[model samples]
Target: MKHLFLFLLTLVAFPFSYAQQAPFQDEINQFKQQDEQHFPPKNAILFVGSSSFRMWNDVQSYFPGYTIINRGFGGSTLPDVIRYAPDIIFPYHPKQIVIYCGDNDLASSDTVTAKTVFERFKTLFTMIRQKQPNVSVVFVAIKPSPSREQLMPKMKQANILIQQFLKTKPHTAFADVFTPMLNDAGKPRKELFREDMLHMKPAGYAIWQKALQPYLLK
Candidate 1:
């Protein structure tokens, strides 16, 4: 009885402990409440990752006839997504999962290498497969941005690794948003971004929409 009681106590405390360490507790809580009121339908597309997806408030409009659920939170890294996977990812029975995360992982001030980012992605990918064995996963290539120009080399390396990994997996697609976002000079185009030069403007998102449109399943 004591061991069973201890196990139940751990279960109760685990969520609170994770919440304290998780970057965006309030955002996760709000998502939970909103979902309870109006639950997202099963077999819809789930877009998750960093601020980029969160900032895409008009994502559904871009897809036109798709059921896209955006669970993106700002400043999220690969590990952060892994930590919050249960809340944002595992609950929904999404037909396809479109991810856009490695950008912030490489762009952040922390010291993580391209290989580290790739492995983190592999972990997340494996977890998703374990939970939803047959779900399609579309990994949006770690984009190139003018603001983080210096980190482009590492970002490209990570994108390459992920793209290759996805090619080896079934029902997976790597949306190469990075290549088209570049200019003739092989650099991020200022025209594709806002004044901040970090986030996408309409031009960049247009490219993303085109690249991802084919893989989307409504």
Candidate 2:
């Protein structure tokens, strides 16, 4: 009888153990708490994703008049965003959301395939759309970072899947930061990258600002 009880306990505990083993959840949570503290106003524009968005120190200045919120957390993946979506994004009731994520998921040691990345993206988009029907959604194509140059093919594949999905939604737009960042030789321009080669330099951010300006609400 004791053995039977123990077996059932293990059955329930196993899934929790598996689910709780997320190696990146803690870092993401810390970022979410920081974001909650700086919570943007309702009906504002939100930039949610990884380092590119997080590192945008003057995102609001780039798009003046529109109340913009930066919910970017460096080093987070799409799965991480979904895990903390309720706390990080849902409550704000943003008018629009500009997402730039998944690069870390592919380049990380997580072993997540391109297809898995695509599926997770669909899940994230669907969750947002269902919860915020009136919110406009814009996706920035995963930038071609000089540091992550080797991963460009996977990035392109992810962008292709996302772009196709964007086509079906009227309010959704895909901003193509990828093509302009590339040189005539079809490579990430070194000048745009900081010394780390992974993050964007001010020039890069300027380009991002230029690309983003037109889509913003007047």
Candidate 3:
């Protein structure tokens, strides 16, 4: 009877402990380790979101004259970013924040609508404003990926919603990387992407660089 009771107690507590563990915790810890070694410059432009920014290993080269701290991790959804904001966002005290998220939120589940993405983005924006009221923010519009072609409508709608929301706030801008990535036939430009047809090649990043340049702070 004692053994059975102990086993039942373990079963009851196991799932709860597992559920509380955060996603991408290892990545966040790595960032913390790097920071401990040598902290990043304050007031640099911070790019935080999903794999799009994470995979941009040479983002600094494209910008030429600005300091950039790229904290994008995993195939992160907006909620993941919000969960890790204290670790990734607030510490840097960035002069500007360039976000490339939301499409992943839509792709994560069919139930996630454009409005859901919009609201998530608003929550992220509000959190940032509450912590650092004067920091500039630039949201990179979700690009049309050939692999996720079906989700484009949701992406576009989320883009429109976020763009409209940003207009109402000060020190904010929307970087339109979406329109340029689409071909003349209004489809995703396949050439811009890698063989995966999802993540971009250099060509895609080139378009993003051009779209985002005007918005980056000095």
Please name the candidate that would achieve the greatest lDDT relative to the true structure. 3
lDDT of 3 by residue, 66-168 (tens): 9999999999999999999999999999999999998789988989999999999999999999999999999999989999999998999999999999999
Write down the TM-score for model 1.
0.89
lDDT of each model, Cα atoms only?
A: 0.90, 0.84, 0.95
The TM-score that candidate 3 achieves is 0.92
Better of 2 and 3 by lDDT: 3
lDDT of 1 by residue, 1-218 (tens): 99999999998878567656657878988999989999999899999999888888899999888899999997889998999899989899899999999888876765888998999999999999999999999999988889999999999899999999999999999998999999999999999898999888877888999999998875
Query: What's the candidate order when arranged by decreasing TM-score?
Result: 3, 1, 2
Q: Candidate 2 has what TM-score?
A: 0.83
Highest TM-score scorer: 3
- Each prediction's RMSD over C-alphas, in Å, is 6.5, 5.2, 2.4
Please write out the lDDT profile of model 2 over residues 111-167, one tens digit for every residue.
766677788889999999899887888888889988888889888988899989889
